[model samples]
Target chain A: MSTIALPHQERGASFWRLVELVGCYVLGLLWIMPLLYAVWMAIHPPEYEVRFDLFAPLTLDNFIAAWSAAPFARYFFNTFVLISVILVAQFVICTLAAYAFARYEFKGKTVIFMLILLQLMVMPEVLLVENYRTMVRLGLVDTVLAMGLPYMASAFGIFLLRQAFLTVPKELDDAARVEGAGSVGVLLRVYVPLARPVYVAYGLVSVSYHWNNLLWPLVITNSVSTRPLTVGLQVFASPDQGVQWSIISAAALMTSAPLLIAFLLFQRQFVQSFMRAGIK
Target chain B: MSKLSRLQSQATPWLLLLPAAVLLATFTHIPAVTTFINSFYTTPRGARPARFVGVEQYQSMLADPVFLAALKNNAIYALGTVPLAIGLSLLMAIIVNSSIRGRALLRMSFFLPTVLPMIAVANIWLFFYTPGYGLFDQILANFGFSSTNWLGSPNTALPSLMLLGIWKEAGFFMIFYLAALQQISPSLAEAAALEGASRWYYFRRIVFPLLMPTTLFVLVNALINSFRLIDHVIVMTRGGPDNASTLLLYYIYNTAFRFWDTAYASALTMVLLAALAAFSFIQFGILDRKVHYK
Candidate 1:
């Protein structure tokens, strides 16, 4: 097989390979064009936003202007508190439920698991109207808690942790039991340590998701005190603001920078874990 | 061994599951049922208490032009995005998976959009599509073409949004394809090469069929995404100059919040829920068959 391909590779394959390479490079440039544009527009003065010049003077005026145009500090603080609460709650709730599903057998177990899985397809966002009413009824409307409650019991987290827990060797459970360690102790010491990678992967996904999520937050929180960055950016970028491209781009980059920087720094782990997390 | 211990074990699972089960019931299941029930009631107005009006909201939704347009637009948006995005991502995966120079940079560029928020991407694209002096128009003018209203025009608005959808999602789908591609043994490619099969022929006969499971998984996700990924629509067009890009979920949002028509929004949500349920059924059926095959 190697011999046959060697001759062909010397014949027409190089040309085609070259074409494929060039094609990929072009596509790559096209893919990253928006980000490049954002950087260019964001750093340059408003006049040079649409103009491309290698010698154009760059400034931080856009960022300074965008910062003052909205209460971004409050928005960032709201988003920070929102994602932290949600991630913590998800960890606790999903760990317990996943441990049960992975290790225990009880009546109606299958039925309960199926019910939990149903949320995978029928996400809370689908029933936003009713969820809003539920929030209002609880007097949680316009609060950051309202933004995070629906996502506290995450189906994806439970499923991922359950898979992770199932992979822990039964011998470890028995050894822990022989040492007179309770089930909770076994889970905390053994299973949790074993599932650290899964936890990191799930945590990254959850943080990025809630950070970028806009629609539900927009619908749930109307006050500046509770609005996340995405909603804040949306309000900032409204067309009625007369298309301040430079300032808008600055705000956009500012809001997305944390995730983008983390992704760039942890590219391999981010991609690998996303794959390992079996999002597909 | 003892009856008491057996009883304790029996209660353990349920006790552990209590918090999750309660939260899920409170948020997901209960809200879903309420959404269904609320769809059958009229929106309560000042000095006018809510009353049951079975199927009236649904009837109005049927008669409502905006709802109909949104439904049609969403269907078109899904049809446009799902296949194109899948195909583009597959191509991207194949390209990156092969022995190409600068593959790391290429893969990073492809995956970059997935990291950025839709609102940010929409803002950048808004500048690109801006009339007269936008990046696109500036480039087009270099070729003596007139500037066009990419997002403002009805004919191009939905497609413009679709383009953003594809750009934002194809890289995400590419990661999945890349994972699948890496799993395929290289020996098959050697065998295909021994048979003197061309690259296209090998991909068509060997690579694609081997990727069916991944394709199915990606297809379900893409379908769900078509409904969920209206963030760009909100940021870019806000469903457009004439609701040309109004998707079902976005329409539900407007109906409920902007108009304060909760009952009508619930009715719209019921339709969205029904669509999701159908997709889930299809997914589970396919997944079950795949499991059986395994």
Candidate 2:
């Protein structure tokens, strides 16, 4: 109350509230303009495209055309494999590290943890040159495995899971140990079930990120077979040779549908997951 | 239970860390070392030696106009996106913080751009910018202005990319602010309101100061994304129209793969790494002083 500078006010809540309502409506339309536009283009044929006619005839021709035009099924499969591999690998390895960090006392734990944190700051994108060279040396370039391998050891995931694991009571750990549960048993039976939300949060973040990732896949993959949808969509859309905007939007829709559907289904969890992931 | 040996008993944490350590070492650490090594040598096509050129590549990379231009564009991109997005999100957070109607719907609208993939957003926006068949041009045509080349020109490419980026990222950052706003005590606002404080006055005085910590966090997050987030440019611009939109990461891609200048790319990598570390240090410094963590 003391900090309130009433006389210094330019715009108050009442002013800004109206501003926000107008803002919400205007900006909401702007924010969704691209999606709506894409949907419009995807549904309408060339004659009706961008006519702003309101009564333009719509059809599923774009989807069928886009599907027949590219190896979208294979692209979807590659993206699936790439996402699943990274997700599975991240969970298994990060959980182990997180469990130890959460429960046990160890020498140099902070230093080791700090070292892991270093990679989080210096992402693989920054160090792409050498990574490519290494991949070249190993002949792993253009492989879907190459796409997932770099992100397998996720420091952020470990940090998150560890934070979650620490919330569990030491008494719980003690009880599990006294019950003749080994470290593995305690981790699996006690630590994991409790930290399920963090797991779900991390898994969703990883899936969406990898699902939409383009640059890395673009660099590693060359051919259509090895390409994920993001890169595949790019190749289809890049050179304006013979590609139709309508069909491209359809491909875009197909590429984005799974995550969008997951998001629509689990909107609350998704937002919360992003919040958790961002904070950590 | 039979008691294990002291060595085995003390090995638990180490054992847990081992898997992550191995994978990180293999994937990240090893590749980082390799990128560093490759940066000192010239790995030309059909060349085996990759002659240890010392700092020659570094010197030349420093002199390269394209490299410098990319660095400048990247700086502008960061400057453009970071402050604007954070500020927008802060405003959105403030608005959403109030007992507004359709909170869920508002939040959902704010978050919708985020759910859509960057590539998809770009694709849609690209069409929006498409010369004759696009939305922006169609509007311009209605207004009796000639359609401008949106992404096709070198001058507008980077800024256009920034627009798309800010639109996509504001919601993600808004979520952070919403969370941070939730952390602020509503009683503080009520007390301000009781003191004849207007919403802006309360927000500017009471709320904004309390939100400094969140602002700092958002700034650092935005800065990191601005610097390292070049995935969009790769698909949208490809550092094209005379390398107009080539940020550091995008340039690193070009240097490594397109131009195959691995050594110079290494130096570029180190530069960004240094910038990130310095930015992080600054953030840590601010967080240390201001943030009252619970």
Candidate 3:
């Protein structure tokens, strides 16, 4: 209803606009207030102490302390490696699976698809004990590869990518076949690029989710080298050392920086993907 | 469908499916079997070799006070977090749906909490709930309201965590509503408006009906999340305040890691799977109803 707003008086629009802007500022500040406080605490020393003193100097002391508190670099690297390995593995596996389900008509299709969707409901974390035993049996405890293996074939990703692939015209596949391409070539050439947005959307959602996930990683990874940032951040955050609030906040800010920055940068896309993720 | 032509016609699809099937079977299916098996076993420590005990773990787990407390807390936590988050998000979506200026900014601000790591937000909320110099306390003190032990009080701990859960998840649920809002034709609203219908009336009849499917989806996710989410408890409460915040998954975590009783933990996991199965059944039923209603 463009008409609903258009014929309205300029006064009404201006009043609402002013209200909206004020609301935006207040809500935005409220939303990001914790992170801002973390920045303040992380940069300032303990003596400053919540005194509303804006003029206090900043330093790298908290960062350095937080850095030395654990294998922050290795944790960061592990998280990066874990995301990459899982993303690539999930993309390839889910792509093929999605292609088959999207393009082929076969017996047990509904049954198999239903089973795959069951994983979405029974999230692996809920079955942690059994999965842990499996990992131990495979002698993959405390390894990044083990951390990534369970998620190598994601039901959610397959569902999303299959929905994407199904949107491609069958005429394109026929043309590709006419042009001397096999089924594999048709998938690579015709479907993948057309589904680039879905890939980006799925990839962003996956990376952000796995980046923030802690439970599964905690169950699987014991050593520092395999520990992701979220789990490591916990070791700093979950201590009985009388609660070093500032340093802990500092570590948390560091841990969440990547996903937060990505959200800030691609706010619209992030929101859109989240909407898609929700609906699916 | 084609045993004779299976080698020729069925080769490609099965080939494509091999990797995913293998992984899902190994990781998901195999663990399912282990879950069924382990629930029947007894192990002294997680390190010790286990022996079959035939539902002894389940029987003991049922009688265990700690397990009962955890289940109670989980019920309250689930009941608390899901409804409030969905309700608030629906409200937020309605507000954003208005031709409000700076809607994009407000939307982004609302969604900021979802992007932060659960532990990070839990840590921040933990500090805010901390006794003194905390945000909640500081604001309360300034307003002449003496600070309450938000997370420390047994009565308040689960609610406090539920509050955090709502704050973190409402924006997430909002996006889904927003998307659904976009798809509702403006003409429908206009036609109702032309009938001299009040905004409330129009929304009651038109918008709510249109949003039924999205609501179902949100509800399913919220239910799943109440069980699936363990990170927040690990950071925020550690199932504390006399086990007031103890959730099912968090209890399983304690059984496996803290108590070091792998058999009991496996039994606890089976309970979680049962909860999840119930949730899935409800979700599917709701989805079917929504489709029929639509």
Q: Specify the highest-lDDT model's number.
A: 1
**DockQ of the two-chain complex in candidate 1:** 0.58
Sorted on TM-score, best first, the list reads: 1, 2, 3
Global lDDT of each candidate: 0.88, 0.80, 0.83
| Tens digits of per-residue lDDT for model 2, A1-280 | 2222233345545675477477666766676667777888888897767677788887899999888888889999999888988899999989999988888889999998888877777776566776666678889999988888778888889899999998999999899999999999999999999998888988988898888787778888999888998888887777555678888888888789998888888888998888777664
Winner by lDDT between candidate 3 and candidate 2: 3
Give the worst 10-residue stretch by lDDT in candidate 2 chain A: A1-10
Q: How close is each model in CA RMSD to the real structure?
A: 2.2, 3.0, 3.0
Candidate 2: residue B103 Cα off by (Å): 2.7
The CAPRI quality class of candidate 3 comes to medium
The weakest ten consecutive residues by lDDT in model 3 chain A span A1-10
Q: How many angstroms is residue A278 displaced in model 1 relative to the true structure, after the best TM-score fit? A: 2.1
Writing each residue's lDDT as its tens digit, candidate 2 over B1-294 gives: 346766776888898899889878776777677666666777666757668888777788789898899889988999999999988887666656655567676677778888777887787777777776688889889889887787789888898899989988998889888777777775776676667766666777667777777788788878888987776786677887888878888887777777776667787887777788877886877565866545
Stretches of candidate 3 above 4 Å error? A1-29, B1-6, B44-49, B290-294
Candidate 3 residue B232 Cα shift, in angstroms, is 2.0
